[model samples]
Target: TQLLEQSPQFLSIQEGENLTVYCNSSSVFSSLQWYRQEPGEGPVLLVTVVTGGEVKKLKRLTFQFGDARKDSSLHITAAQPGDTGLYLCAGGGGGATNKLIFGTGTLLAVQP
Candidate 1:
């Protein structure tokens, strides 16, 4: 049973605030991806970390993969109203079932 759990299913914050979202699992993954989705649209890939303890940064967003490949994290610095959206984490096993497994999902609202 491979499952991914995410904390803080919902978040509301003021502009310029910092926030972190977590993704955890009991099974190892070959790769992990972070995505941000808007209303009525597909999620946009934010980052993909393949190696354990790998870290990647995109502008104000930072992503980290767990050393065991069973967890990941996303940190946003100086969050703005424009950052309000749904954040999703997906894991890839890299086998015959290379399909991604998504977390429950997170909704973030950044008030101006």
Candidate 2:
């Protein structure tokens, strides 16, 4: 079974700070996705990367897929208080099932 692991399990920073979270796995995945979960809500999909070496940006957040498709990263620029949440990275097993393996997750807190 493939497992995704996230780094820096916890983070707390002031508003306007920059940070980067990483997701890595030994097995390669067909696609990778990033999500954010708040206190009382399910995770919200932030971005997805289907191709190796693909990079996608959403406003202040940037997502990148490694060249080998076995790793991914999320970088937040000038993070705001609203960005505080649990950051997750999921790998998709492309097929009929479309199964996904989620990483451990990163907890982020941005203080004002």
Candidate 3:
């Protein structure tokens, strides 16, 4: 079983500041995904990266998959209070089940 781990488990920053979160694993995955969740809500998919060394952007946020497909990172620019939430990284999709291995999670608090 693959275990995904995220860095900076908790982050608190003021508005307009930038931050980066990392996800790592020792196993290679066919794909990786990022998600954000709010209190009492399920996580919402933010982006999915299927190729090694691929990078994707969503507004002020950027997501990158590692060249080895075992790591990923999320970067938010000029973070806003609205960006406050729980960030998660999931990896897997190598088999028919397509189950995902989720990371420990990162809780970000962007204060205005």
How far residue 70's Cα lies from its native spot in candidate 2, in Å, is: 0.4
TM agreement with the true structure for every prediction: 0.97, 0.97, 0.98
Q: Cα lDDT of model 3 overall?
A: 0.97
User: What is the lDDT of every predicted structure here?
Assistant: 0.95, 0.96, 0.97
Least accurate stretch of 10 residues (summed lDDT) in model 3? Answer: 92-101
| Model 2 root mean square deviation, Cα atoms | 0.7
What's the distance in Å from true for residue 62, model 1? 0.4
Tens-digit lDDT track for model 2 on 33-97? 99999989999999999999999999999999999999999999999999999999999977799
Q: Give me the overall lDDT of model 2.
A: 0.96
lDDT of 1 at 53: 100
Best by TM-score: 3
- Per-residue lDDT for 12-107 in model 3, tens only? 999999999999999999999999999999999999999999999999999999999999999999999999999999997597998888999999
- Model 1 per-residue lDDT at 61: 96
**Tens-digit lDDT string for candidate 1 (1-112):** 6799988899999999999999999999999999999999999999999999999999999999999999999999999999999999999988796899999898999999
Candidate 1 minimal-lDDT segment of 10 residues? 1-10
Give the local distance difference test score of model 1.
0.95
